[model samples]
Target: MSITYLEAIREAQAHALRDDPRVFIYGQDVGAFGGAFKATKNLQKEFPGRVLDSPISEDAMVGMAVGAAIEGMRPIIEMQFADFSIVGFNQIVNQAATLFWRTNVPCPITVRLPFGGTEGGGPFHSQSIEAIYAHYPGLVVLTPATVEDAYSMLLEAVAIDDPVIFCEHKFLYYHLKAEKLPSEALPIGKARIAREGRDLTVVAYSAMVHEALVAAEELSAEGWEIEVVDLRSVKPLDTDTVIASVARTGRLLCVGEAWPWGGVTAEVIARVASEGFGLLDVPPQRLNAKDTPVPYHPNLWMAHRPTARAVAAAARKILRR
Candidate 1:
């Protein structure tokens, strides 16, 4: 039997609750309703009162989690949608993020964000907000691309004595699967080379990692050896690994589902240029979702985000240059 990305996440939470008595899930409809995407499905029944639901207010939910964490509770807050997290931005960036640094009291809260675009999810439901949270100093931002990372990373996030933003891509929940849950995993803040090559390196995370893999395979047929790097975490970004990959490939192309302006892709390019400029044989390039609100139409939605086809085309352009 194959376990999907969503199941891996639920199972990880179950494992955390079983092992750590201080760990509990708190969010809107997370207890009885099992969360908006059913990420916490049947968790309330299994763990009982440990999985309690909160009011509709995102601000209140985060604030309560912060208070709970201050008192030694590891609370996992699930945002119904990535876009909705902005409602609790102040609580996240200022309060939870600064708690440990200001008072030397660790805030061990994990905020689960069901991020990225889906067909017809439109502007309200679809958004990649990793870059926003990653900007802060004290917060650890994670974007899990595969079923294994989805399982392992959550366990690690809950154990850390710091605030964590876990961005689990909605597009991969059901679509990506593995034979079984992983027994071990790469530590957080490490980047994994999904594919190895010499001609170019494609850096990506979340749903965009799959697209980069597809693009790499497509290029392989045309005699272009493309390397694909899966950036497991954004905030504690493994710049050393990224720079080494660029040194080997000598060409860089970053891809992301978020908009082009000031996003993770831009950060990756900036780091490569600043740290490993001499290693790059060609100018580094990147592809991202168009700078527009996610559209309601299926075709427009496809066009709005970076697709496998678009990634491959960008790689071809960079390889040729």
Candidate 2:
């Protein structure tokens, strides 16, 4: 039976809880309601006291998780929506992120954020906030693009001693699937070449990785060989893999679902330019969502985020240059 990206996440949590007694899940409606997106469905029944429901306050949820982590519990905090995570920004950045550095006590907490734009989700429900958390020093930011990565990376997040921002794209939950659960996976903080090519490299993560693959197939018909790299974790970015891809292709096109302002796309381009300037045959390019709040209209939402067509068009420019 095929396992979907969403199911992989839930299964990963189950495995973690079963393997470790210290692991517990906490979030709004995560108990009986099964989370806003049902990521925690039936988990409360399986794990009993380990699965818990929190108040509506995001800040309180994260704050309490931090405290639990300090007491040697591995807490998993699920934000109803990624945008709501901003409500707990202070607790995440100041408290959980810095706890280990300040006291040498590890904060082994994983915050699952269901992020990215969905039809009618609007600004409040749909947001790609990975870059914001990645900016912090101690936080490990992860964005899994495939079902396997979704399963392995989350398990890794829970096992990690540092606080982790697990950004699971809302768009990929049901749309992507795998034949079976993976027994082995690439380690976290590594990039995978989703599609290999010689003409240009398209660096992407999360949902954008799929879009880039679609764009690569389209470009291949036009005699353009496009390479697609999936950066599994935004923080601790796999610069070596990205720079090597650029070295082989000699052209780079970064794409992201987040806004254009200093997002992951920009960071990738900046790193490539600084560390591997001589490898590029042309100036690096990037594509991102428009600098505005996510719109409720489906058509507008499609236009706002970087789609397969948009990625292809952007790649064409880089390839031709």
Candidate 3:
């Protein structure tokens, strides 16, 4: 049976809970309500007290998770929306992120941020905050693009001793599906070449990876070959894999759903230019959401984020250069 990205996440959590007695889920409405997106549907009943609900305070939620981690429990905090994670910024960046480094006590806490733009989600609900958390050290930031990755990576995140920020794209929750969960996956911090080509390289992560693949297909129809690289985890970016792709194509186009200012796209470009400057035949380029608040209207929201059409257009520009 085909499983959706959302279902994969729920299954992963269930698997973690079943396999490890120390692992539990703590989030707002995660108990009876089954989470804001039902990502934890029926988990409370199956796992009982382990899938407990939390108070409305994000800061308190994260703080409690950190304390639980220090005491040897693996706690997963599911932020209702990615944008709201900022409310607990201090606890996440200060306490959880640095606990291992400062005290030598591992904080095995996984913060699940259902991120990325969805129609009518508005500025307050839709935001890609992965880059913000990625800036902090001692935190592993993961962005899973497919259903298989969603299941496998989440399992890995819970198994990891370091603090993890798991950014699961909201847009792919129900839209993307796979025949079965993966038995194994590439290690975290590794990049996947989604499609191979020799003309140009399009590096993307999360929801943008699918868009880049679509753009590659579109370009293929025009007798242009485009390679698409999916950076599975942005924080521990695979610079070697990216540089190798650039070496083959000699052209790069980084795409991201976040705003265009100093985000993942910019980071990828910076790394390529600094570490692989000689590998490129042309300057690396990037495309991102307009530098503005996410819009409320469907049409405006569509225009705000990077789409397949926009990616194709950007690829064409780089291809012609």
Q: Over the stretch 264-285, how does candidate 3's per-residue lDDT look in tens digits?
A: 8899999999999999998889
Candidate 1: Cα lDDT at 244: 95
Report lDDT per candidate. 0.94, 0.94, 0.94
Residues 194-288 of candidate 2 have per-residue lDDT tens digits of 99999999999999999999999999999999999999999989999999999999999999999989888899999999999999999999999
Candidate 3, residue 149: the lDDT equals 95
CA lDDT, candidate 1, residue 76: 94
TM-score of each: 0.99, 0.99, 0.99
Off by over 4 Å in 3: none
Error of 2 at 47 (Å): 0.8
Q: What is the per-residue lDDT of model 1 for residues 181-270, given as tens digits with 9 covering 90 to 100?
A: 999999999999999999999999999999999989999999999999999999899999999999898999999999888999999999
How many clashing pairs per prediction, in order?
Answer: 0, 0, 0
Q: The CA-based lDDT of model 3 is what?
A: 0.94
